[model samples]
Target: MTEKNAYQQAGVDIKAGEQAVELMKDAVADTYTPNVLDGIGGFGAAYALGSNYKNPVLVSGADGVGTKLLLAIAADKHNTIGQDLVAMVANDILAQGAKPAFILDYLAVDKMRPEVVAEIVTGVAKAAKASGMALIGGESAELPGLYAKNHYDLAAFAVGVAEREQLLDPNNVAVGDVLIGLPSSGIHSNGYSLVRQVLGITTSERFKDLPIAMQETLLTPTKLYAQAVWPLVEQGFVQSMAHITGGGLTENLPRAYAKTLSAKINWGSWPILPIFNELQAAGDLSLEDMLLTFNNGLGMVLVVKSEDTQKVISQLSQTNQAAYIIGEMVNGQESGVVFEGDAPW
Candidate 1:
């Protein structure tokens, strides 16, 4: 038998890391914009920011896929989660009305597996291209002690540029502005820890045993919103926007507007995704917990003037993006998100 090298014996494989990089090279190249100045092997990636805006503001967001990674890894599915990683950050900056320009990812694993890493990065590259961002650079860390074998975590930092005056402002989000919701692709990337508990997915084998379609649905990558909402931002059609994430609508909506204003949701205006309903039944969870955690159905919400509501919804439909008017901003004393009617649970 061939003897293991010193580093290999220590659980760090340099050859494997190099191979992973080689495998991901093509995918990474595919996402490069004309502004990209360096290749995958460079010490640092570079991009030339052409003078595009009169007064540019840089918007950045950092996030991980959270426990959603657990489900993907358990199922040995690597392709789509990378997109989830990208979406978490991309959508966040989009909430600020910024156009995503580039992304840097960090992947850490217990032991480097070239094929798996490549698969993950290919998804990332695809998502970056879709979101109009360059996959500029990233790191693949093999930390033996920090993670379990065949286990890994992925995070991304996205940087975007927006004109100073065009950035979405909470101060400008006035009462009477209508709320428009964009549907989600499954739960996106949050509340998965609860999902696993609710579904009783206690082991990799159990997760793997689920019907293939269900597995795919559960692991569906987060939807990129730059294509859907950027046009509205460019046209000054939206006063503010919220990317419903870990905190769901109850928490995230308030961040989009001034504290004096409250979002009043008209329950049952939009149909909740079946997956959330299934989870609620299985876990016997209260409506409050569901809203406090999962997005229930909507992924992104826009604050628009009532006059522009139909125009905004019509434009989204033209792009094959389905949006619904779910609520409106109110001048009432209630703070944050205020529920008006009971959800048709």
Candidate 2:
């Protein structure tokens, strides 16, 4: 056998990798814009900034799907995980009022499976397009001993640009500004480490007895808010924004505004989803811990002037998803977050 064949014998198949690229070509092409100067097979992706901004400030973010990948693999679900990978990072940059331009993803697998790779990349392309980004390039590798059989890890890096003069600043958030809560679809993409444990979601079991809605949500991808919130940012309707992730509202909301002020939250203002309540009861977890770990029904929070509250909510309503006036910004050097009403559960 030739050297190329020998490499395949060791489990890394060059021909299979080439096949995977071929399958994903059409999907990747769909996300390209005039700025995507080069296609796949390049050492680096070249995207032109062009004359889009008077002064362009680049914002970049990187994140993985976290332990959520374990559940997807266990259930043999590979599609939506790519979107989750994109959202985990894309939402972070979007929070700072950046317009997404391009993204690159990385996939590492135990074996060379072209079909699986194509499936994942297709999902990535779909999400990137929704976020108005060009999926310029990506990498997929096969390592024999590194990952377990049929297991892989996924991550992505995103870059966006905002006008230097228009970048959102927490300092711009006034004391009377209200917080608008964007409802999440179940857990989105965080706290799976606890969710998997409390619910007995093991590698061998796929929640057959669980309610169909809960079962489907376990692998649901994170929602990309670019479509709904970008217009608000462009119109200067927002002061600051927060993307709820690992630390939930407890940690994320504080970053949306100045450290000198605190957020006065009306706990019963919005309805917490049943998923959170179920997880809380199943794990016997306290409200504090639950709030810290999960998104608690709100995935993204925006700080807007009290006057713009209705306008923002009205605009967001067109998306057909509910947005709520859950809280307000206030003067308090004491704590970053202060709860007023009781949990609606």
Candidate 3:
């Protein structure tokens, strides 16, 4: 009997990795945009944002869906996580008033399952298309000993472009500006680690009894603001926008407020999603945790002048967007989001 070398015995298969890469070549190619200068496998991805817009400011952000991938694995649902990955990065930059131009992804797994890989990548492609960005490229590794079977980690990079004068900066925010909140697709990939810990439940179990519409809500693709808010921004109806993510409104909203101003969120004004109520009930999570962790339904926020608020809300509604006047900027020494009344939870 011949003894195998240490590398082979440990299950590190360079040939298999190469084969996996070869197998995904075509699907990868489908994601490329016109600005993509080269194919994958280079030391780095080369994208030319080249002379596309006048005085273009490059906005770039990188992020992962975090332990939300654990939920995807537990549910044996690979499709939606990819969209979550794109949202994590794209939305962050979109908060700065830029439009995503191209995206790159990174996938690391114990072993590659072609179907699962395809499902995840397909989500990325679909999301990129929805956001008007091209899924330029990505890397997938088959590391046998590093992860559990059916367990994988996903991340992405999104680059956007905005004119110098068009960028939304916190400095422009002022007192009396109104905050319009957009509804979030349930738990859009943040605070999941805490959620899982507190719920003491599996993703499949947590999602099982939900109505079809609600389950779909969990898997619903992220709401891309590039199209919804960009026109308003270009038309001068917006002061600044906040992309509600990891830190929730308790943290993110204040960042967009001036140091001398704060936001007062009217609890009755915004619609809270059912999933959030379920989480709070299941975990007995305090209001503080709820406000600081979960999105509590609001996703993206647009801070606009009081006079422009009604027009902006009308336009968003006409576009079939669920927009609400959730709060107003007020003069205060501290910058933070203050809930004005009791939440139904």
Candidate 4:
């Protein structure tokens, strides 16, 4: 009798793993710039920073797609979430005024399926290219005992570089600075647990009958701000920026402010997407809770001198990014952020 391999009996398919690598190789290579020094299938990815700076600071961020992955798996849509992974980390690094250089992903699944893995990596490669970040390498693990079949999770590490003098510092944010709001794609990758609950996603009937538009809204990928905002950062146009993720504007905007300063957001100044309005009505959520949980409609908040607000807005408009003067920084009381006028909800 032939001896059986314990690893195969445990359900890890080595052949499937090899197939995944072969399928993803071309997609990953497409994201490479001259900086990437090694091909795929290496034990470690290699990149040459080259001699490009007076003072270089490597900025890195690690983040996952959060519960948004659940929805992706539920909907059988695997592609866009990889972009969500890249956007979450790349945008965070961009907050520090860094240009993303490369990214690595971590994908763990209950079972290895080459097609599914390839689809996921294809999306990662797409977003990496779009953000000008090289998709240098990543890991795909198959753990049969840990997750149920068809269940998986994704996380990513993004590395960026900035000149030491050019790194954004919230300490530089001061009173009288204007706050510019950048439009979000939709709900993005945050508050989906509440989103699922609010929308009654667990019920099969509810899931099947979800409004077509609403379904699309819920799955919209996070916006990648690096390509759009990096030029502004390089030009010293942005003093500070907050990427609105899980915390919404109420929490995120303040991250870019000095302690002595508070953000005064004009609640009705920008358009609140219909999806947010729907969530509020469905969940009966108060405006405060909504602002604290979801992004509402703005995905990013940029702090700039009052005099330069128009210039910044105009430049963003040229790039087809709709931006609005959503608020201003003022002497603080106790809260870091304060809203003005009636709540949009």
Model 4 global lDDT (CA atoms, 0 to 1):
0.89
For each candidate, what TM-score against the reference? 0.96, 0.96, 0.89, 0.96
Number of the top-ranking candidate, with lDDT as the measure: 1
- Report how far off residue 131 is in candidate 4 (Å): 0.9
Per lDDT, what order, best first?
Answer: 1, 4, 2, 3
lDDT of 3 by residue, 1-345 (tens): 977778767876565556666665666677677888888678776778777577999999999988877767766888778888888888888788887888988889887676677778778877777777877777787788789877889889888888989988788888888999999877888888887766564546665655666555556556666767777887888888888887789888877767778898888787788778888888888888888898888889999999998899888877788898888998874447677786676
The models' CA-based lDDT, in order, is 0.91, 0.88, 0.80, 0.89
List candidate 2 segments past 4 Å from native. 1-4, 206-212
RMSD of every prediction? 1.4, 1.7, 3.0, 1.7
Error of 1 at 127 (Å): 0.4
Q: Encode model 4's per-residue lDDT on 69-140: one tens digit a residue.
A: 877787778989899999999989999889999999999999999999999999999999999999999999
Q: Report the lDDT of model 2 for residue 89.
A: 81
Q: Model 2 over residues 1-345: C-alpha lDDT tens digits?
A: 455667888889989999999999999999999999998899999999998679899999989999888877776778899889888888898899998889999999999899999999999999999899999988999999999999999999999999987788989987889999998877988999899889987653656566777777788889998888998999999999999999989899999888888999898777788888888999999878897999988989999999989999998888775899988989975789888876743
Give the range where candidate 1 is weakest over 10 consecutive residues by summed lDDT: 332-341
Candidate 4 or 2, higher lDDT: 4
In candidate 2, how many Å is residue 21 off? 0.9
Scored against the true structure, residue 257 in model 1 reaches a CA lDDT of: 91
